[model samples]
Target: MKTLSKKDIKQLNERIGREVFSKKDLLQEECGRYYRNKELVFFTLPQGRLAPSLKFLLKDLYLPKVTVDMGAVKFVVGGADIMRPGVTACDEGVMQGDLVVVVDETHGKPLAVGEALMGSEELLAATSGKVVKNLHYVGDDLWNA
Candidate 1:
């Protein structure tokens, strides 16, 4: 585990286009640390990039999200890729290659973070096949980490 310095936090905030942690949050609470292991991988969220763990922690805040039907929840939490047929809704402005949080329709809780394989319009129009490449999901090593 490695704690992020104030400079690192500032750089991360700039890269993500939002302040993820205040100095107090990091210094006082010791919350800005990166954990890495064979099962869990940690890295900075690159400029304009999003990670599943970050999305999960900030779900209450505004973020682009994709909703999958309940039937897909099991597969998603198991780290299976998202399929267009299972997607029930998507936030507007989600373009191809965008980072997206995957949530179940029942409770609207994030289940995974993924890269959009298609734009929102294309995702909604498709009737079948994969739509998002699952990067992280509930019950995965990152979640446990």
Candidate 2:
């Protein structure tokens, strides 16, 4: 478990809008007293946190090592309009602007990586609009990274 330094605690107080917890309080709040030596900590995004919140959690919260992968999900891919057709299926519980691993329809492998343009349910329901907003090239996507 990585303990916060004095500077880190001060910054957390400024960002979280509360006094930073002492080491013992942080141990309770962050680890529930289950201390481990692992450096890579896995955390679920807090409920109702949109893109801005994620950005803050990463940039300000010292979550330097994180896997933003949304795992498997369903959403429309490659369409002129986002709110219309082409949505074969999507995974579950994804939100807009989330970093996701877009899979290929044929082989079920990663086709590309990008931020979601709409919620999973919204993408499934709508027939047209931008769906998965492309971010980087993968498996020979036409766009440049």
Best by lDDT: 1
Residue 94 of model 2 has an lDDT of 76
Q: Residue-pair clashes per candidate, as listed?
A: 0, 15
Give each model a TM-score. 0.80, 0.39
- Report the alpha-carbon TM-score of model 1 versus the true structure: 0.80
Error of 2 at 14 (Å): 19
Model 1: weakest 10-residue lDDT segment is: 28-37
> Best-fitting candidate, measured by TM-score?
1
Q: Residue-wise lDDT of candidate 1 within 42-123, one digit each (tens)? A: 3334442535373334434355889999999999998899999899999999999888889889988888888899999999
Candidate 1, residue 2: the lDDT equals: 50
Candidate 2, 1-145: lDDT as tens digits = 4566656656544554455344343321143111113211122233422121222233234211111122222332332122224445666777876655444445544444456777777877776656765433332222211
**Model 2, residue 49: C-alpha shift (Å):** 15
